[model samples]
Structure formats: structure tokens, C-alpha cells
Target chain A: MKHKPRLPQGLLTTGSITLTVLVLFATLPGYASIYTVILLAAIFMYIVLTLSWSIFSGPTGYISLASAAFLGTGIYTSAIFGKMLPLPVVVGIGGLASFCLALLAGALTLRLKGIYFSMFTFGLVELIKHLMLWFEINLTGTRGRFVIVVDHITVYYVMLVLLALTILTAYAIRRSKFGLALQSIGEQEEAAAHTGVNVTLVKVSAFAISAFFVGATGAIMATRWTYIDPYIAFNYLFSFMPVLMAIFGGMGQLYGPIMGATVFAYLEEILITRFPYFYMLFFGIILIVSVLYLPNGLAGLIQGWQKRVWGARYVHP
Target chain B: MSILEAEGITKHFGGLTALSGIGFHVDQGEILGLIGPNGAGKTTLFGLISAALPPDRGVIRFKGEVITGLKPHQVCRRGVARTFQSVKVFPNMSVLANVMVGSFFGRPNTVSAAAAEGESVELLEFVGLSAFAAIPARDLTLANQKMLEVARALATAPELLLLDELMAGLNPTEIGLAMDLVTRIRDRGITVFMIEHVMKAIMCVCERIMVLHHGEKIAEGTPKEIAASKTVVEVYLGESAYA
Candidate 1:
């Protein structure tokens, strides 16, 4: 009857792996080439994005595509304010702006379930993108707001720290009472309500937390580029890619998004370098095959294999 | 003291009347049986009382507090827990974890995961599902799934437990076990409100019976009185042969 894992072996293993990765990442800039550092920074950005998606949408099955809404809010906040403020302050503003947007969206759409919820969230990004474009043509001239570009190495270290914080926060949430409540809502909203879970409160809080993460990533990344148009800031690519990567890695587990982001980021870099014109086509083909074979994501495939070899002994919750 | 009091409870779904002017009271520690033919408003009545749906007309009181318009979770927090007519276990979670969710969310005194787990294990044992605690709920047999539902519902520590057809697909032996479990639940000081099609179990176990026909309360009495009532027999005969 007592089936509690007194100490979570899976969590411990995940924590140790995360720690090792963190240590290695911290030491990278000392000896690694500038290209390696830049590439890793971009990879770290991807990890933050995918994990942000996973933390809210993965366990809850909400299928939110509102990342660009949050991401663009952050980017534009930084773009408009970066020149007058400190880098950390600008990033904080970006995060706050995105969190505000999430509160608005969660209030309006958290009642929607399944495919309707997905479409509404998908529409949210599009809504933000178009509104920004409209504002630019009607008021602000063709050129978008100017940005303050920080040094690449400083940006790199900041990204590493942000990525670590996002993951640690995500891991902590997955094990907390908040995590359990959201996941219960994910599994069965009615049942969760019946069990005394404050469904609206849990969901709205999760939405804001996820938005804060993506917003911070977007705010920091916005300064790295020379141009800051609505097109660049509110790219649909950022909106959709994190979702796909999280699904690929196994959204069910906390570490799943990290694995997905890492693999896809490197694969993207290699394909762009080698295939140039045909990279997306190759990416599409590879992604299709992986999704078809590993329906539960890469983590699921690994779990299934581990279960077979280990004879199904104490699989993680 | 009455655990539940319903007055003039009525529900309509776009002109289809589900319940109308149905009044009932379930006393503390009473085992009340609810029976009706399909579309007889039994489940609809349950839904209104449990706060899954709001009544078009009437008031529902639980432990003397007006709970008619409360949300389902609010109702649960006030000590009402229910099982679905269909098996509604959290499929991906372990049986123990599934029960733990209820205790963790529904019990104010359970402050830690370990405490919830210990309490949930006890509930699981009470419902005879202790051996399957670590297994995912999806893998359980339907009969055991019913038992798991009871354990999960019990984890809420409800003053009134509304069981929606817990014995529908159960074997005869399983039904016997279920009957015993229901009695034990009452013995543990929880009021029981159950909807059942198994006449033998309902007749033998419930202290009283309420029959609904076309959203109207046509009969309310002890099991033997219900069996002998001409209106009850006529209502069942109009729909189909009574089980």
C-alpha cells in the first residue's frame, strides 16, 4: 500500500545531470571559441523556450501557441526602453509585460478545452503579430524601435544563467503542489475541480510563469540583432518551433523538453550549414520520422527501452 | 442533522426537463438509494446537488449551508465527493498517486506529500486496492477501477459520498464485495447517496429509497415499501422490466 518513492531516484538523476551540464556551461567561455559560445547561447535560448512551453502546456495538455505573444511583448518592451535603462531592468520589464499579457489571455481562454484551447492560443500569437504590424504602418514609420546591443559574451553568460533558472524553476514546479494541481487539471479538469483544486487560480499562475520565462528569453535575445521589426520580434517560427521540440523530447517529463531542445538545436545548426537551401526539407523529413516512431517523444522511447531492460521496476511518477 | 437537503430542484437543458420540484433530505449516516429508468433524472439530480450544474429552480443545502450555486470544487471543499458513472480514474498516474491527489487537495490537515501518501494508502487498503497501489490506474480491471474510484473519493474525507453506479459492470462476487465496502463506508460515519440498477444490492443495503420518473419524485420510502408501491412498479414497467 505504501508506494511512495521516499526519495525520488528519477529526480535525483535528473538533478545530477542538470548540475553537470550547468558546471560545463559555466566553464565554457574560458576556453571555448567565440563561435562555440555563440552557438551554445542560441542553444540555451532554445532550451528556455521549449521548457517554457513544456512547463505550462506539456503536463496540462493545453497546447498553447501564445509564445510569440509573450516573446514579442518582451522584445518590443526592450526595443522601446533598452536605450534608457540597464540591461537587467529592461529584461525585467520585458518579463513583466509578457506576464501581464499571459494574465489577460489565461483569464479569457483558460476555460476552453482541447482543440479549441489550442486554436485560441494559436490565434493569440497571430493577434499580437498583426496588431504590431498595424501600429507600425499607422503610427511609427517603416523602421521599428531601435535597440541597445550588448556584448555577445555578456549576453552568452546571461543566457546560460537564464536557461539554468528556467530549468530549475520548471523542475521545482513539476514536483511542487502547484505542479500536481496543474497536471490534475490537465488530466481531467472536472475531476480536479471535484477534488477541490482551484482550477482557474492554478492555470492562470502557470500561464504567467511560463510567459515570464519566454519573455525574459526574448528580451535578452532581442538586443543581439541589428533590426527590430514586428516581423523579427513576433516571428511565428519562435511560436511554433518550441512546441514541436517539446513534443519531440517527451513533454510528460521535466527533462524531456531540454533533451528535445538540445538535439533539435544542434541538428538545425548542422543542417543549415550543410544543406543551406534544403535544410528545412531535411528537417521536416527527419522530424516526421522521429514523431512517427517515437509518438511519446524521445524521452518516452528511452523510458520504454529502460522499462524493458530493467523489468519495469519503480518507473518514475 | 441532515447531510443534504434539496428543495424544488429543477433543471432544464433547452426545454428538456431533467428534474422538477424534487425535494429530498439525506440524514447524517444514512444509506440512501436512488433508482429510476434511463432519462429519469437520477444523475441530473445528483449533478445539481453536487454543484456540477446549477438548478433552474430551488435551493440545495449541505450541513445547513446554502450550496446551490457553488462550484464543484467549492462543494467538495464543503465535504461532498462523488464517483463518475463512467470510470474516471487519472489513467497515467499510479493508483496510490491518484488517491494522493484527492487527499492532498481535499484534506486541509494533510500538509505534506508523505502524509497524503500515508493517508491515501490507508484509503486504498480500506477499499481493497492496496496491492495495486503502484500500478497505473489505466491497467486496472473495470471492477477494480470501481474500487479505486471509491478509494479516491474517500480520500476527500467527505461527509456525504455520492456513488454513481459503482457496481454497474461488477461480477456477482465483486458486487458482494462492493456491498460490504458500502456498509463499511457508512460505518466509518460517512453518509452514502448511491444510484444503482442492481435491485438486490439496493434493496438489501439502503435504509431508504427515492424513485424519480420523468423528473418527478413518484416514490420515497424504505426498500420494501418501494417494491410494494404500485406507482414505483408502474414507472419501472412503463420504461422496461425492473432488474
Candidate 2:
């Protein structure tokens, strides 16, 4: 017997609300303050990074700390080729460069499990950063390069499109058979392999796909910073922030990381402006408290509240 | 004709030999019981056949084609599937989804999602887990989890199914049910090779039994012949007792 795919309740309302928000975002440059547009663009970047990170790490349980490597690849691509190529072409090439790097790196190191895999990826950022620094010092005789600056409005629009694409990709993957295979791999890798899932291929491909978005985001965001060196481009914060945001948001559902990044980024902005010295202190405290109390993150907390409020009426399928 | 043949199968872990020059052949459409004491390399042999682990020195053939060096997934697609000795269900996935993984990727050809889902449900029903289809697999009892593993293996549509200690943790009633399930599975025309410690269930269900002692095949024959075999009896109930 044939069965229709089941969607969760209130998806229609959520879709409409998202569409309305997108419309507002699309038209924001006309009325909103320049600062607000720039701030929102930063928020969008965080969302893309977190969502992309989750697309691979969330389902497959492969925690990679190589976001900076991919992002740096994009930033460097833009720094080197920004003047030579059109903006779209530069961004595409940046993404493709990271994709290839991830493909190579994934094939080599994806065999390592748990903390070993994570450590290898973490070391990858340092490796790339140092290698780039050495290349600049020896071959190019340059420490850093100035990226061609695009207007704030253009940067905002590009980020928004990338955000939309990342979301769509994440959502599509979460619902597809491929997503099921990823989840199974996370649950039991050996069993998944024995059950006919090509564990290595699925893992390496997912890792590479995730890097593409981070690279693309870095390509666009590079314009915001006119001058960048290896250290600036490959800062480890870009790697850890996505993981933190995803944990805070929850990885169980598609909206979790998005909500986490948006709220977290907005909070960071407000705290930095209000109390620059104490902002990081407060942030650390809040993260610790959330980690301790909210084991499943915001999504799980929301799910619990919904179950209590709606009783048996709410089915979370 | 034998559906699976392993010749000169030897495996070593550093200094310890898991299996030494082991050889066996399982006939097509027969339920063959592999019984041995703890660490006789019964599961190791299964791992070798299913390509979970490679043998250091051996040739394994399925349908007369060497399958020794293939990946686990490749072996599975070539119609050999296995259940783990310790149940390995996808804990967070629903019971039906656990089975659906097999249906979706087990065979050589791609299966439509709807068809896979339907087949999964039917397999779940076959294993009496239809009632728990929506529940996460981890929430099921150990016996039920093993049943889910069986259902999942069956979803792969394997011609040769390797069941490793399927009845180990089962109670007497569950053991009876499991024995019946094995017979039913054999009747479906799939070759069954099982590693089992539960003598009653294994003896009643398997058409032929192979005895292993310290990684060597001590005896191989029908259940009655095995029961009367001197070496097989001595290996299980120490030689001093018969002496």
C-alpha cells in the first residue's frame, strides 16, 4: 500500500512566517539602518556556518573542527582572485576550492573515529594556516592582501541568498533517504556498513558538502574585511562557534541551529555594545548553564514544552 | 552445490590466532549450525564471510566468485547479510527505519522509498515488532532488539543470512519462538548459517551442525551424527569424563 509523506503540524504557519521574514529581509536595504543590514548579514553568516556544520556533523556524529580551513580557503581565494574575476565567479571558485580540499582531507582522515577525527580536523586548521603563512613569506613575499570591497548592501544580499540556499539544502537532506543513511551511520557505523551503506563514501561526501557553504560564506564575508592575513582568515573561532551554536540550538530538527545562530549572534552583538569587558564573561556563564541544564538544547526544551502544552494532540513525527 | 566456501581461512591478532587454517562449506538452502565453546572463532568466521574483517590468509567464495577482499557493504549487496552477536540497531531511529535501512541499501538495485518503507513494515510485522514501529529501537527490550536486527537483515533480501548468537539472551519461551523463526526463514529458501550456543534450539532447527574446537572444525554432520560423535562429545564435556 502506498503512503503519503507526513509533515509535522503547524508547518504551514512556520513556512508562511519564514516567507514573510524573507520578504522583509529582501526589502530591508530601502528602510532599515545600514548598521542593522550589516548586523543581519553577520547573523546570516553564522546561520549558514552552523547549518552547514550540522548537515554533516549532526547526522553522522563526525565532529569536524575544520571550518576555519575551508573558510580560510575561501577568504584567500577572494584575496587572490577578487580583482581578477567577477564576484560570483570568485565566490564559486572559493567554494569549489574548499570542496576539493575537504574531499582530499576527508578521504585521508575520515577513518579516524571520535576524538581522533576531531583532533585531526582541528590540526588541519593550524596546518593550513601555517602553510599559507609560509607560502606568502617565501613564494609571494607578502604577509596579507587587500580584498576588493563590495558595498554593504551587496554583501548583505549575497549573504541572504547563501543563507536561503544552505537552509534549503539542509532541509532537503534531512528529509531524503540519504539523510536516513547518515543518521544510521551516526547511530552505528559498522552496522550501517554491514547493512549495505557505503560508510566512507557517505561520510566523505557529507564532509565536503558542508565545507562548500563555509567556503562560500567566507568568500562573501571577506569583502567586509578589506585586509586579511593567514591568522585573521583562519581564526579558530569560526570553527568552534558553529559547534557551540548548534549545541545551543539543538541538532534534532532543522530550525534548531538556525534559531541558535540567530539568537546567539544577536545576543553577542548586544552584549558587546552594552558591556564590552563583561560580555565574554557573561557569554561563558550562559553557555555553561545551558550545557549543564539543557542537555538537548533549545529544540528539546521547546519540544518538551509543546508536549506538555498540547498533551497528546502534538505528535512530533 | 555449496553457496559459500571458505578455504584455508586463517586470522591472527598479533600473537593470538583467532582462526587457523579453517575450512567450511555451507550448502545452498540449508540451515547449518556452528557450535563452539567461548572464543572458538565462530563469530570471527562470520566476520570473515560477511567481510566485516578480512582474513589474513584465505579465499572466501560466494556463488563461485571470490568475495574475500570486498567491503562489508559490497558483500551485503552481493546477497550476504548478517546480524551482530551484540545487537546493533540504530538506537535513535524508529524500529521501522532500522529495518528500512536494510531494504533501501541491502540489494544491488535501488529501491524506491515507498517500496522500502512498505517492505520494512512487513518485515517488522514478520518479527512481531509492528506494534513498536514508531518507537525508537533503543527503547525495545534486548530480545525484541535482536528480533528487530533479524527483521532488518531479512529486509536486505539476502540469499545467505548469517545469524550470530541470535538466541543467546532469549528466555526459554523466546528461544522456542526463535527456533521456529529460524525454520520459517529456511523455508523461505534462504541459506542460514548460524553461530549458536543454545543447543536445544540449534539442534532442533538446523539441518546440519558443524562443531569447532579451538578454531578447528572437530566434526560436521546432521544433528544425530553430531550427538553421537566421540570427538564432539569430548570437546563439549571434557575428555577426562569419558576417560
DockQ scores of the candidates: 0.64, 0.79
Q: Which stretches of candidate 2 lie over 4 Å from their true place?
A: A1-4, A7-11, A312-317, B237-243
lDDT of 2 by residue, A32-131 (tens): 9999999999999999999999999999888999999999999999999999999999989889999999999999999999999999999999999999
Q: Rate the local accuracy (lDDT) of all candidates.
A: 0.87, 0.92
lDDT of 1 at B167: 93
Which residue runs does candidate 1 get wrong by more than 4 Å? A1-17, A139-143, A304-311, A314-317, B108-110, B237-243
lDDT for model 2, please.
Answer: 0.92
Spell out the clash pairs found in candidate 1. Answer: none
Docking class of 1: medium
TM score of chain A per candidate = 0.94, 0.96
